[model samples]
Target: MAVSAGTVMPAAADTDPRGYLKIMKAQEMWKVADGTGITVAVIDSGVKLVPGLRSESVLPGVSFMEPPLEHPDQQYPPHDDFVGHGTTMTAAIVGDGSAGGPQGLAPGAKVMPIRTSIGTPMAFAAIGESAKGVRYAADNGAKIINLSIGGWWSLDKIRSAVEYAQSKGVLVFVAMGNEGDGNESANPIAALPGVFGVGAVDLTGEPLPSSSYGHATDLAAFGSKVQLRCTDNKGWCVADGGTSYATSLASASAALVWSAHPDWTANQVARVLIQTAGAPVDGSKRNDWVGYGVVRPRMVLLDRAGDPGAPDVDPLAAPAPAKTPTPSADQTSAAPRRAESAVAESGLSWQWPALGAVVAVSLGLGITVLVKRRRR
Candidate 1:
C-alpha cells in the first residue's frame, strides 16, 4: 500500500501529474472502448465507494479489515479507507461519473474490490490469506488482478499465489516498491517471478527516486502530483505520487486493451505494453529504474501495434529461463568485493543489520576431500 505525500510536498504537488489531463489522448487510444460486461479484480485495501465517481460501476466487496475482530459487519459493509491510496486507485480504474474529476481509463469496466491491505508488515496469517484472495477472484471470473503492495522481505504465499493466478489466465500487476533504495532492498511481490513489476515517473517524464528499481521492473507510468477523487469522498481530492499509484494506472491501461480485444490472452496484453511503452532509454534497452518503459495504454489499443500470438501461453508464464539472462564475464567464479563499511553507506541512521550473510569460503564442506577418498 502507498502513503500519501500531501504534507511532505508543496501544495501544488497535489495537482495532476503527467502534466495535463490527457483525457483526449486516453480516449483516442481506447478507440475500441467497451467494458460494459468485464469484471476486474482490485485486491488492495478496502475501497470506499465514493458517490461522485459512480457507485454503480462497483460490485459489493468483502472486507477482512473492519473488525468486531472475528465477524464482519454484514449490513453497512466495510469498504472505508484510511490511507486514501486504494480508494484513489479504484476511482482511477473504474470511475464512470460525469462529475468531472479523474475519470477512469476504462469507465465501463466493473470493479470487484477485495481488501488485502492490512497493517504494515502484514500478519503472516494475512499474507497467507491474501494469496487465497487472488485464488478466489480467479475461481470466480475476474480477468485481471492488480497487486499494488510490496515489502522489504518476501512472503512465500504471494509468490505461489502469483503463479496460481497466471495458471488460471489472470493477468497480475504489482508495484515494485517505493523504497527508492535501488539494489539495497528487494521488494517482494514485485520481485516475485510471475508479477509484472511497475516503477514511477514524474510529470516531466523523469523517474522518481522514490520508485523501486530493478531488472524485476517490467514497466513504469506517471506517478507524480496526480489528481484524483478522495477515496473516502471527503469532498476533496488528493495527489498521487507513488509507485502504488503507478500500478493502478498500468492496471487500468491493461483493462482498456483487454476490453477492446476480448479474444486476446494476458500474455498478448503484456506484450503490447512491453513493446510500445515509452521510456526514453538508449537503444530500446531497459533500465534499473523504468524497466521496459512507461506504459502507453492508448498505443496498444489504437495503433494496433502489439502482437497477440499464442493465446495458450501466459506472457510471463515461465520463470526466466536458466542461463538465459545475460551475465558478467566472471559471474560463475568471482567473489564479490566486500563493502567498504558494514554501515551500508546510508545516512538514514540504519545500523548494520544483525543478520548479515558474509560468505567466507568458495566451497562448502571441502568437496575435494570426498573426491580424494573415493579415488583412494
Candidate 2:
C-alpha cells in the first residue's frame, strides 16, 4: 500500500518551516547543483499542471490508461490527473514553489509525466501498462525512472522493462512499501538487483515501523510528516509516512548528484550515493531496517565524500557483508539516541515532534495503496 495520501492541512508560507529540507540540508546541496539537465520520469497515475509545476518543469509524455470519454478533448490528454498522487510525487522532485506550493528538492530539474493506472484491485493489464511506461521512459531522454507504486507479486514483463531501462543507463528507484512490518517479501520490485529499494525514516532518523525492509532495502530517507501539494487542497498536505515519498526524495537526491556531475555514468552515481550514506550505528555496512543509513547528499555535494568506484561496476551486484544488527539500538530506545548523536555530531539540528504528539492523517479519496513483486 504505497499510495497512502496525507490529510489536507492549511497551506504553509514555505517548505522551509518544515524539517524535511533542513534535515537533508537541501538548501546547502542546491547551491552546488539545482538538478539542471536532468529529467526524472515519474511513472504513476498522471501529473497535473499545478501552480508549483506550472513552469516548463513538466514535459509531455505518454499515457497507458484509456482516456475518459467525458474528457476526450485531444488538447487535454492523459497528463491531467484527478488523483493528486502523481502531482505530489512530481512536486517532491521538481516543484518550483510557484503560488505557495511545496518546493522540490531539485527544482531546476524537469519531470516527464508517464500516466498509468495504479488503483487497488488492479487489473492484470495494469502490470502491462506499468511495463510499457518504464520502456517508454528509457527510450526517451529520461536519466532516472521513479516508480512510487508497488504491488504484491513480480512479473516478467515489468522485470524485463526494468532491465531494459538499466541496460540503457537509466537509474530506477522503487518504494520498499508501507506494510508497517518487516515482511517485504511480498513486494519484490524494491528487491531487484539494480533498482534502488528505498525505505523511510522519521525526522529523528529512526526507521519508520511502516517502512518495509529486507535484503532489497538499499537506502533510507526522511519520509514522515513530509509536506506535499495535493489536488485535494490548493495548499499542502503532510504525508504521515510512506515509502512513496521516500522514493521520490531518493530520486531527487540522485538528480542533485547527477546534475553536479553530468558526465558520470549511472553506476558511478549509484556508487557515490551508497558510499556517502550514513552508516548504521552498529558500524555494519548496511542493515535490513535502515539499509546503509539515511542518504546524505550533502556529504557528496559539499564535503566531497565518497569515491565513485569503477564506472562499469554495479555496486549491488556484489553481495555485501552480513549485517550485524544492533538489537538494542535498531529495535529499541538506542536507535533514536544514535540518530540524535549523529545529527549533533554533524552540526545539524533536526526538529522532530514529540512521540506523544504524532498524529496519523486520513488517506484521500481514490488514493489506493498497491503492492508489486520484484523480478528476482
lDDT over C-alpha atoms for residue 360 of model 1: 13
Residues 1-376 of candidate 2: C-alpha lDDT, one tens digit per residue: 2233434554563344346777667788899998999999998767878777765888988788643356555332446765566777788888876655556888889999887654322322445677888999999999999877665333578888999998899999887666644333314666566888877777667767666666667777777765565433245655453677778888888999999999998899898988888777766677776666677778889999889888878878775547434344344433331232223111111111111122221122222222223233
Candidate whose lDDT is highest: 2
Cα-based lDDT at residue 215, candidate 2 = 63
Worst 10 residues of 1 by lDDT: 344-353
List the candidates' TM-scores in order.
0.74, 0.81
RMSD of 2: 6.9
| Best of the candidates, TM-score | 2
Tens digits of per-residue lDDT, candidate 1, 1-376, equal: 2233233332234444324236326656555774655677777665776654677877776654434334444332337655444566676677653443456767888777777534323322344545777787787788888766554332676777767787788888777666653222324566666577777765445666566555566777766665454423344344544676677777877887788888888888887877667743443355555666777766666667777777775555544422213324553233211111111100000011111122111111222121101000
RMSD of each: 11.0, 6.9
Local error of candidate 1 at 341, Å? 40
